[model samples]
Target: MAESTAPPVRITSFGYGHCRGGLRIPRAHLVLDLRTHFRDPHVAPELRHMTARDQEVRDAVLSTPGISELVEATAAAVRAYQAGPTTELVTVAVGCTGGRHRAPTVALAVARALRLAHDWQAVTVIDRDIERSVIAR
Candidate 1:
């Protein structure tokens, strides 16, 4: 059978604090919360205003002890879902306190890992709250 070329998975990053009112978490096959397990870059004055798109913010988040392992594990889970009998889009939702830091950074990392592993030719990552105003904790 010829391999399908459509992207098989989507990853979204959100901030739990942004869910007030009508904003909602994206529905997904897997939802990983980093609010407790990972450190927040927003705590640092320098990183507070930056999004995951910034290299320094990316560096800080990726340097956290367990972030790399979590990214690999999430990719593995996506692989498991793809192995299922039905061919469907797999969605992964990653959430952190403000969504501008840890969550988006990790989501991008997971996409990178999956691509490096040749698990998928394309992976979509949406930074749901990366542009939103920083949440004051």
Candidate 2:
């Protein structure tokens, strides 16, 4: 594989509610608000405590009527970043009501797709509220 000059893509999952004062997205090129898209997993008794990493939560997020379309759109944008200026970083922030569930799920899905779709590009997913280690590949 050819050596990549493209900057690493940073994807963050955050809660819109967490931005009590304001949301800070470092080097964010695009922000996708998922607040209105998927049904809230927190409302369900089974999924309430689960992170987006759980199979059931991920399924709920992905199974929405038009959710797949958004995923495809997001992946397409990340691929486009590969062709853009290498010196510039691309960041896509996915935000929902609470970062714990929906946002992370969507971000992870996109990051995985981006990784497979563009193997040479570096992709990372982070949950801002949860403060877990960055998931990258």
Candidate 3:
């Protein structure tokens, strides 16, 4: 008797307006944005006062009613992927005002959450703009 190996699972990140239409089958995509939830002036005063680097930002992002809802939505998507039987890959897009700070940070956090919560494999964070710049001639 011979043992079998399962195909690899992959997680990927993308920026706003980026697309991934050409990839082969057995892949899933999850898109997210900090600006979509955090750009409003109505965020809690306590969260407003916290610096972006503060751990409070993480807590606040996870707890904000709208953002938390989004997180739940994302979790559900991941769950669906996990329940399926296929070699799976997911590309999640996270957007913010600039590619430098909030977007990347939240994307990283989301990747961490997915891996920890679902025991996902191979999470990759990509700064789309940075990649574009590097590839530009």
Whole-model Cα lDDT of every candidate shown, in order: 0.89, 0.77, 0.49
Error of 3 at 69 (Å): 3.4
Higher-TM-score candidate among 1 and 3? 1
Candidate 3's C-alpha runs over 4 A off are 1-28, 40-65, 130-137
TM-score result, candidate 3: 0.52
- Among the numbered candidates, top lDDT falls to 1
Which residue pairs clash within candidate 2? none
Better of 1 and 2 by lDDT: 1
Ranking by lDDT: 1, 2, 3
Better of 1 and 3 by lDDT: 1
* Model 2 lDDT at residue 85: 59
Better candidate number, 1 or 2, judged by TM-score: 1
Q: Write the per-residue lDDT of candidate 1 for residues 1-137, one digit (tens) a residue.
A: 34555448899999999998999988999999999988888889998999999999999999999999999999999888877886778899999988999999999999998887764566889999999999877
Each candidate structure's TM-score, on Cα atoms with residue i matched to residue i, is 0.93, 0.83, 0.52
Writing each residue's lDDT as its tens digit, candidate 3 over 24-74 gives 221346555565656422144664434334676555555556665565577
Q: Candidate 1: list runs displaced more than 4 Å.
A: 1-7
Per-residue CA lDDT of candidate 2, range 13-126, in tens? 987777756656434788888877677777888877677878998888888777788888998987787687576668899987778777888888888888777666577787
Quote model 1's TM-score: 0.93
Sorted by TM-score (best first), the order is 1, 2, 3
